[model samples]
Structures are given as structure tokens and as C-alpha cells.
Target: MDGSSPAAAAVIERVLAFLDSKTVAACKTVNRTWYTLATIQSARNIDCHILQLSLRIAHYKRKGLLKSARSLTVDVSFVDGYLSPAAYERRVRDAAAMLQSSLMPVSHLKLHASSAHAALTDGEIHHGTTAIGLLTRALPSLASLDLSDCPAPLLTASRGECVASLGRLCRLKWLSLGSNDMSSATALRRMVRANVRTLVKLDGRGDVTDPTMQLLMDAPQLRQLDASGSGISDDCLLALVRKRGASLRELILSDCVRLTRHSIAQLTPKLLPQLASLDLYNVPVTTDAYQSLFNAQTHWPYLRDLKLKAAIHHASSRQESRATDDILESIGRNCPRLVSLRLFGCYGSTDSGLSAVLGNLGYLRELVVMHHPVDPLIDEEHSSSEAGGSQSGSSNTPTAAAPAANGPSSSLSSDADVWAGIPSLPSNGLPQHSSSARRAVLPLPSTAPSSPRPADAASGASSRQRIFTSGALRNGVRSQRFNLLNLDMTYDSECAAHLAKLSHLHTLCGRMITRHAKSLIEAQFPKCRMMVWNID
Candidate 1:
């Protein structure tokens, strides 16, 4: 009964396989059998790095655990001065040779680069030797490959050599070339065309163009396609969203600057009927279009994940417009089944906006929003993600996860199953750096930068009891609060009470929030932990 079934051993193996590192440690005290199961599961999701590359590989080989690695993250990324340039290259060469020869049948492989601030330093240094050739050449059996943190694109030894070798790869199920320069468009397209039959999820990181989307219509099983920040045209986008591609579920088109709300409104229920997660990061959508696209009763009744950024098109969008607020309200009323609602540039939103989302969407396990507008200093071009979990927030999505995409410095990343990571967003090839912004989250082992904490909001803490209300959550889903918030506005005691009611808050970025409110919330829910920006 201690495990998944009424008996200790029954179904325990499956249950043990899902525990994170922390949970795995706790399982050691349960019993020897459980300890063994937890240990194996932990080993399955180990990190293969460069600090002692050969030693690590030898250890894995000796134990015969190399072949059992389900989700392997070979994060060899270090800073510029971490080691001498010669030493760095030598270690990388040695690691690559070993990994190539070892041939660990790891289904999922995540490759990292030298440092998060690779943008400011050398151009293609590969500080940690996160070379594409190293990864693809070594893990030939990779079914899922993620390179969101690499210094450059998948050009390992030579210009087009490693990418050309992608043709030899076993049909990939999941591939994320996060923000890496995919200028080798022809080669990248060829690889996709070849693997069209097996490629299920692709995180292009916005480096792709219209042709890639065109090539995917024939992809019978392509469920998730993230073209965030790509130059995909409206016509091509519409063409791909048809009955033929109805199997498509998650579609991300953030910062497709060419898109208009009118074209977006055309996406009725008839197009990609199985749509669940839609992320339009920086895409310009009109107020009316927002309502129509998210028409739960009329359109996507099964929609779960919805990400809409505030306007990036200043000329077309009206400043001080209440469009975003209205849109959030509509979402709460319509998409009640939503699991994750992430809004990045929603500077126009106020208390009412977040309140509506919190009130409805009772089943929401992850709510990521920029509760306050970004100051001029806050970087928006870079992409930052956590190195903690998998791709999706939930466990059913992917075995391993990354941090949330906080623009390459204010990082965090995942969900229940979607190989939890930061929206599976491709980086701009350069890892992000942190700023002196304040962010708070459930305690965890993290490295996000922090600023000065703010003073308590004591003067405004009136003793009179206040009813901070947010219409009842959709379900009596009490154990159901999972949100990641980064706010800069000052809150009174009443605001804190309202937030406290949101029981399932997962992570929060209180960059300029008062200390009292943060302390109150952390005391109630102490689970999720990421980025460490400071308060006012």
C-alpha cells in the first residue's frame, strides 16, 4: 500500500520509475527493494558531463547501466575562464570519442554549451564543447535530441557535416534545436523530410522558415510543432492546419511577426481539431481574434495549454488598451479545462486579469505569467531555461525536462509529463544571462541570479479582515495550485490573501513584491523551486 497498489511490491516498479532525484533519495528509507528501484530510476536519468567524461563513461560501462539510460543530459557547458582553451578542446575531443564509441542506447539526449552568457563572449567557442558533432556522432541511437543551450547550431566538426549525418539517425521522435542558428535550412529540411514518418515533436526554436511547415503537412503523426519566432507566413500556417494534419495537437508560433489576427481568427474547430496546447509568444492578435480562437464552447473544448504574449507590434496595437485583460477574462470563462496558461508580455494586465485565470481553470497545474511589465533593462531577446526537469510540465509528456524560458537569464523550466523543460523553446543559439530582477519560487537547488529583497508591506497591512475573492475554481481541485508568477507591482495585504487562495502555485517571480506577501505564500506551498530574482 505504500506504493501504487495495495501491496508494497505490486506496481512499485512503475511508480518508482517516475520519482525525481529528491523523491528517489527519500525512497531509500522505504525498504531495500524500493531503494533498488529508486536507484535504477535515478540512474536512468543521469547527467553525462565533461568534468570527468571518461571516468563517468567507464563507470557507467562497468555497471552496464549505460544502455539503460532513458533520459541522458550530457551538459558539458562551462564558462569562458572555467578552463584553458586548449584544455577545454582536449576534454571535448576525449569526451566525444568516448561517447561515440560507448554507443549508449539513450533514447533522449540533451546537449549543453559553455555558459549561459555565450552571447556576450566568443562567437563559436563551444566552451564546454557542446559541439553538435559530438552529440550526434556519439549517441547515434538518440530518438529525442535537445540542443537548446549549445553555442551554435548542429555543425559539429565542419559546416554541414554533422547535419548531413542526421540522415543516418534512426527516425527521431522528439528533436529540439533550440534557438541555434539553423541557417543550414536546406540540410535541416532534408533531415526533417527524411524523418517525416517518425518525427513527432519538433522544437525548431524559430530558426526555421515556411518551407519546414510545408514539409510537415505530410507528417501523419506530427503532433507538436514549435515554430516560435520563425518567418512562417499566414498562408503556409493555415495550409498545415488541416484535416490531413488533424493529428497535430500542440502548435507554437510565437513571434511569427508576419501573422495578423484576421488570419488567426480563421482557425476554427475544423482545423487541427485535436489542438490542446497553443503558444503565440509575441504574435500580434486582436481582441476579437483572441476571443474566437479560444472559444472553448464553440472551438477547442479540450484546450489545455494557452500562451499569448502582450503586443510586440506597437504601431498596430493601442497602448493602455484593455484588450489583454479582456482576453484573460474570456479564457477563464471559456477554457476551463486549461492546464497551463503562460503569458510573457502581458504588461496591460492588472489584478483582475490574473484573478480570472486563477478563479477558473481549476485543473490548471501550471500558470506562468509576467504579472508586471518588464523594465527597459530586462532582456527579451535571449531565451533562458532551467536545467532541472523535463520538456513538458507533466511526467506523461517527456521523461527529462528543462527550465522555463525566462529570456536566457531569469530561467526556470516543465510540467507533469511533457519531458518537462522551458516550453521546449529553442534558444537563440546563445544561452541567456540573468539580471538583477527579483523572482521567488518553492525551494529547490537553483542558480538564477537574485536582487535585493523588498521591505514588508506593513504600513498597508490593515488589521481588518479582507475578502480577497476570485470566483470559485472550476473544480474542487484543492491540491490543484501550480502557478509561476513574476510580478513588479506593490501589493497590499488583501492582494496577498487573494494569491494565498490560489492553492496550487508552483513557482513565482516576485522581483519587486513585498517580503511579507512572499513569506506568506511560501509558507503555504513549498514545492516548486527555480530562478532567484530579488524583490524591491
Candidate 2:
């Protein structure tokens, strides 16, 4: 029962360890020492969901328990189980008051709120203005602020006075205002111009326009930018490329359908040199565009990841033959360092193109080629070759050829010989090392069973059935293999698994993977130290 006894010290140590394991709520029940440690840890990553938690955190500050805390997160979302809007607002104000008066200010603050429901509300104008006001006045020392899913009403209200308040945040380093409808790009430009010196990462997805982009391009410290779904044109992207080439690391123009090949060509030299990752998903880029991107000796030398979704077209006619081949060859040769490549829904790519990639990109770890025509080489034809080429007098051979027109038929002939080359891995049993080395090949889901067939097959009909079933088998096998790890069939699971396996993976799209997959990945890869998953 002695206060200084060894037993008392051991008990205190056990209680501290238990508190460390539990979250803020559970830790609160422990004694004073445990409470102190919990407060410190909780304040490191504050969840501004429950109003009472914020209130209690404020109380701790007043009592000087959280003097050593450095970071605070304020999330105002109903999904996170935050209080009702009115009550949440009051709590925010209370916390802001504490922050404003605290002896030690939080160095970093994150704000996440979904105003989609508010945007659709009847009295949105009032609600939006009030919410913006509360946020603008809160967390004065915030170094990073993420305003994703902010309501359109809030973004457009009062001529962007709220956003202009964002300019007043002199210490802000990162700002992400994705998925909001900012009606006036001019106001956003003003805000960007005002805060250009301190801002580093700018993500104005779907809301940014040319004028706002111009302002961001002029920003001094801006390094990472994501304007995906922002309706950004080639000209706007070019301006950014020309101005911010040296400092930039990542640029995502996904779903900007207006991005043409010519625009990409113009921006390539200026943007590709220092870029680590580029996303051109759903754009109208052609082979020439890719050629231009890698044409420069220094172009994307540091590039590690590239996403090309639905960018190319099939060589249906004679004119497209050279273009398609040129594009495929350029990707194979120039992007050897690419570790992660996603060619989702690209129609022009064939087995030749894929073979070029696999042969060159030896260090690839994650490759996604979903929705493209499945290569007979990787599907039924592969197994057929393994069983030995077609037997003599097999009925599979066509007896009569179609009458020729002007030249060789443009359609891909089934009789055309598939590539039989198999590249060897290095002595380490890994692909050659490259800065860009993640490879993923997601073909159209196989219709065949997952199991491999015997050496001999009886009929052509059986082979066709197996080919059709290949997609189903591939999906089923991958899902089953990773199911115990909680991985899904989507691109996210592939990405998460890749990261878990390759410890060096960065700039992953968390949306492609599920939360379950991420957890499993963390459990699997204890050595993976730095990872930032952008779920939204």
C-alpha cells in the first residue's frame, strides 16, 4: 500500500500502457497520469466529431494538461457521428476560443466537412455562410487545411468572402478544396493569390478554372496540385507547366476530357522533368502526346508513377497503324522506370503493347489494365502454346481465306502468331530496378475457370469457353487469395497490396482500395513507414 512501492510503480506502468492502447474515451476513465498521457496523444490527432470531446479538450487546455500538444484535427461531418449542425457550430466556436487564447497554439490543423447535404438544403445560403464563418475564424495557426466536399453554397456564398478569409491564414501550407462548386473562379483566384507564398499542396478538383489555375501557377511554394474533374483545358495546364515545373512533383488532370494531345505536347517539357506522378485519366491524348512527353532527354526522369485511363484508340484503319505502334514503342522504351501504370479502358492497346511494357518495365509492382480486350496470349492462347502448338490437321485451322480487298485486312486476325518471348527476372528474382517500377495488368475479367487446364484439350469450343471464363477466374482467384487480407477486386486492393509488399510505395489512390484492405496492408507491412492514402 506504500505510495513509493515497486508494486505501485508497476501498476502505474501497466495503466499507462493500457491507456496508450485505448482511444481518448476509454483512456479518460484511468487515473491522473493515464489521463495526462491520453490527453497528449488525443490532441496530436484531434477528431472534432463529438462536441463534448472538443469541449473536454478545451477544458484540458484551460487546466494546462495539453501544453505539449502540437497538432489538432477538426472534422465536421455527420458520417463521423458529429453533433447536429447547431450544436457542432457552438462546439467549434468554443474550441476556437480556447485555441485563440491558449498559451501554446496547435502547429497543424486539418478541417474536413461534407456540405453536400447542406448544399441541397432549402436555406443553404444561411447555413453555408454560418458554417464558413465558423471555420474561417477557427484554428488560426493551422499549417494545413483540407476543405474537401465543402458545400457549393459555402464556396459560392457572399462572393467568396469565406475563401478570402482563407487567404488570411498566413501559415497555411496545404489546401485541398476538392469536389466543391465554387461558382466564381475569380474569387478563388483572389484567395490563391493572397496565400500563394505559404501554400504548398493545392487540390481544387472540379472547382478550379483557368483563372484560378493561373493564380495557383503563380504561387511560390506550390509543389503538388490535383485539378482532376476541374474542367481544366490544355491551356490552363500549360500555364501551370510553364510556371511551376521545377517545384512540382505531382499533377492529376483526370477526367478532363478536353485535354487534347496538342496540349499535352506543349506542357510536356515544362511539366515532366521533375514530376513524380501524372494522371491523364479519360483525356483525349494520342501516341504523339506520349511521344512528346518522353521526347525530351530530361522528361520525367524522376517520374515513378503514371496513370493513362481511356487515352488511346484502336488502329482500325491503315492510317492508325504507325501511330498505334509508335505510341506503344515509346511507352515501352521511355517509361522503363515506371513502377505503377494504370491503363484502364484503353482500347487501342493489344498484346504487343502489353508485352512491350512487361519486357521493359521489369521493376513494375502494380499494373492495372482493366476493360481492355484480353490478349489471347495471356488467356487461352498461352495455355495452348504450353500444351504445344496446334496439332497437325487440327480442325482449328481455317480451310479458306476471305477474298482480299486493297491491302492486308485491318482487323486483328485470330491466325496471327502471338509473341512467345518470356523475359527473365534478375538474379534476385525481381525485375530490373527503376525509379518507376509498379506494374499492374488488369485485363477484361476472364470468363474461364480459375484452375489451369490439362496439357491436352479435346475441342476448339472447349478452348473458347475457357477463354470466355478467364475473366471470372482471374477475379475470383485474386479476390479469394486476398480475401483473408480483406482485399477487394477493385484497383484499390491491388494498390494497397502493392504498397504493403513494396514498402516504398507513395502517392496511392486510397479510393481504389477499401478501408479493410488498408488495415490489412498495415498489418502485413510493418516496415512501410510513410504512406498518405487520399480516400476521397
TM for candidate 2 is 0.59
* lDDT per residue as tens, model 2, 491-530: 3344444435443432222112346656766676544332
Per-residue error at 532 for model 1, in Å?
Answer: 16
Q: Which stretches of candidate 1 lie over 4 Å from their true place?
A: 1-31, 49-57, 75-104, 115-139, 153-161, 182-187, 243-245, 295-297, 315-329, 342-360, 365-536
- Candidate 2 positional error at 113, Å: 4.4
lDDT of 1 by residue, 65-96 (tens): 78766777766555367778777777777877
Among these predictions, the greatest lDDT belongs to 1
What lDDT is reached at residue 100 by model 2?
A: 60
